[model samples]
Target: MDVPAGVLGRLRGICLGLPEAYEEVAWVGVRWRVRTRTFAHVLTVEGGRPAAFARAAGTEGPCTILTFRSEGPELDVLRRSGPPFFGPPWGPEVVGMVLGPNIDWNEVAELITESFCARAPMTLTRQVERPPG
Candidate 1:
């Protein structure tokens, strides 16, 4: 699929200073990055098979949207606020399903960037975290 480059470019501008890679993931194109110590990716899954169209937020971190699919109300709000960020309109439930703690656009970008900055070299990192204590 011809994923939009504008979206990926926007993400690149948002998180500079990281090495980015564009590759075919899950049958779709994804942009991934690594910052010497961390990795991050971002993409969109369209059609039946969940394709990945990601933009790397950082090096050494899991990409955005891919990691924000399993959270809670925080994601619900994001789903409701779709468009420009999410692209197209989906019902509350559809939005919730696609955009969550590990799969939404905004949270995905933020999470990927943070994880890339914090992850240690060669250490397996947990992409998502529980609500702050």
Candidate 2:
């Protein structure tokens, strides 16, 4: 299904709030990047691709999900948390969660920030963590 405008809008607000974050669409989905490194993206489970994730994220049809660059343990926590959140088909260090009404916006924002910090360069990370006086 079409990604709700509000869902993407809110996510954009959160991710782009970080240092040097930008958005782009590619083969995978809408990726939020720090320079050239992707810290997060949306997942679209197209037919015949990502079979396992399509089943897990309930995206067998047209659906959009917010995926993040995170650690394996964190992904496992999200997997156990249930609906609107799960691990992607590939990448043990990646986590994805369906963007839907059930999600708490604040939590999503926090997750996005954490994901950005995880992938952003140390230079940018330091700036975000400690702005110039």
Candidate 3:
């Protein structure tokens, strides 16, 4: 299944809003990156094509998955949330979120921002105006 246009548009806005962030077509899907480091990636997982992602999402059917960098308490919280949230088979800091109806766009934006910060250099990350926790 293709990723919804609205969801991609929203992700584009959030990621491109960051300093020095750029979007590109990744091997399987689209990814937003800071320099050479990928901060966020969105792709369709189906038929266990990408076995790791399929296993991570716990599904063989089609699903839109967004993977991003996250850490600390926020990462821990998401990992415990289940379903829409899961641990992608990547680095320690990588988190996978299943996109669908009833998604919290505000939360998605925040997570993308955090993902940017995680991958961006201090020079660029300093430019982001993150909300108070």
lDDT against the true structure, per candidate, is 0.38, 0.74, 0.88
> Candidate 1: which stretches are off by over 4 Å?
18-27, 35-38, 51-109, 120-133
Error of 3 at 75 (Å): 1.8
Candidate order (TM-score): 3, 2, 1
TM-score, cand. 1 vs. native: 0.38
Candidates 1 and 2 compared: the better one by TM-score is 2
Backbone clash total for model 3 is: 0
Query: Which candidate leads the pack in TM-score?
Result: 3
TM-score of 3: 0.93
Query: 25 in model 3: Cα distance from truth in Å?
Result: 0.6
Off by over 4 Å in 3: none
lDDT of 1 by residue, 18-130 (tens): 33422234334444444332243445544422322221211221323433222245445644564323312322322211332333456545645444434423332243332
